[model samples]
Target: MDQTRIGTFIAVLRKEKGLTQKELAEQIGISDKTVSKWETGNGMPDIAYLSPLCEVLDINVNELLSGEKLPSEEYLGKAEENMKHLMQENQNNKNAGRWQGLVGIALLAVAVFLTFGLSQAKIGWYVDCPSIILIVCICAACVLFSGCRTKYEVVHFLRKTVLPAGLVVMVIMVPALLHSLSDPAAIGPNIAVMVLTLLYAAVAYLVLYVAETRMERRRKQN
Candidate 1:
């Protein structure tokens, strides 16, 4: 459900009742700031105020909660069905993210193979260092993603595993990059490896950000 829409509904209801926020708060026994927060979608009304708020607005609790006005029985039934579909879609998205993480690991494995076999003959030492770091990162990400399915787990794993791994990779890769800048022969491959590793790190951070945002919004809803 959209909290913003609920807030908009409340604002409209307040306007219809010809009541300012202060007046609404006075009638409902809440602070004006609480009413403002509800109207602005910054927060939800407390459970104890729900019934009284609806009463003052001359609307049903369901309508207030749902941000809809006396929806027909058939419409309510269809909305419930749509909500179930949305839940299923959310589950599918979570599964797809997991699958994508596995795909990333597979790609990292292939990169490791190519690094050891092809790059070893030309840039053996530099390639081995970053390759090992990349492998560790990919493995750690996969393990954390697999073992921790919830938001808390995701946040903890990112803080304790992903961030540290990324910092280590950067620590190793950065000096190698700086050293390679003095040698034209080493510059191309060094830059390419750095770019790829940084890209992967960025994607990992984005995934965590999205997961955490969804979790926070869900937390608010509950």
Candidate 2:
């Protein structure tokens, strides 16, 4: 199941039908950009879209999976090959995700260390640097990796964690920030502190939203 070969097949089919990329995408209820990506081999169509797309293009799903026209007798073999390719791809993605998860945890650990080290420094009298860093890092990590799960038995975790914990940190920060801003020297750092907090919140929400939407699409497909 070579993407480039499959993409070329899709493009040829669409052109033979006298349909523009936008026209084909309209029929499939997808963006023209997605159609373009498929044709250009920049990305493969999602599995969920494959059936509808094959229907629109008047091609058998096994033939599309094979990236070529296949004889009826060859359908099972082609499908088996496609399944193997898909499984390998899934495993690769999972490995990559595990590496990313490790990196994220390492970052959190460094943030914790820095927070404690900063607390020991004599540089600030108004701000609780350690507390702020700890709260922000923990919240951001939670939001970013909220979808990660462990094989556990009975506890409902995410509902009692992540967003609620974030809210608690925000509540605590309000008064802490107010007090810190009362000092003239603390004004500059406090402004930066506010910006960092907002930036983290924005990024976390964006990542979470994108993750959730992709998960929903996959679930619908399944």
Clash totals for all models, in order? 0, 0
User: Model 2: clashing residue pairs?
Assistant: none
lDDT of each: 0.72, 0.70
- Candidate 1: misplaced stretches above 4 Å? 1-9, 12-60, 63-150, 156-168, 213-222
Q: Mind giving the per-residue lDDT tens digits that candidate 2 earns over 1-222? A: 678888999999999999999999999999999999988888988777888999999997778877788887888888898888877876776687679768977987887678777668433443545545765567556645666454121013332343455456666667766887668788677655655555544445555554555455445446
Worst 10 residues of 1 by lDDT: 120-129
TM-score per candidate? 0.40, 0.62
> Given candidate 1, what's the lDDT at residue 118?
72
RMSD of 1: 9.7
Off-target runs (Cα >4 Å) in candidate 2 are: 118-200, 203-207, 210-221
Please give the RMSD to the true structure for each candidate, in Å.
9.7, 7.4
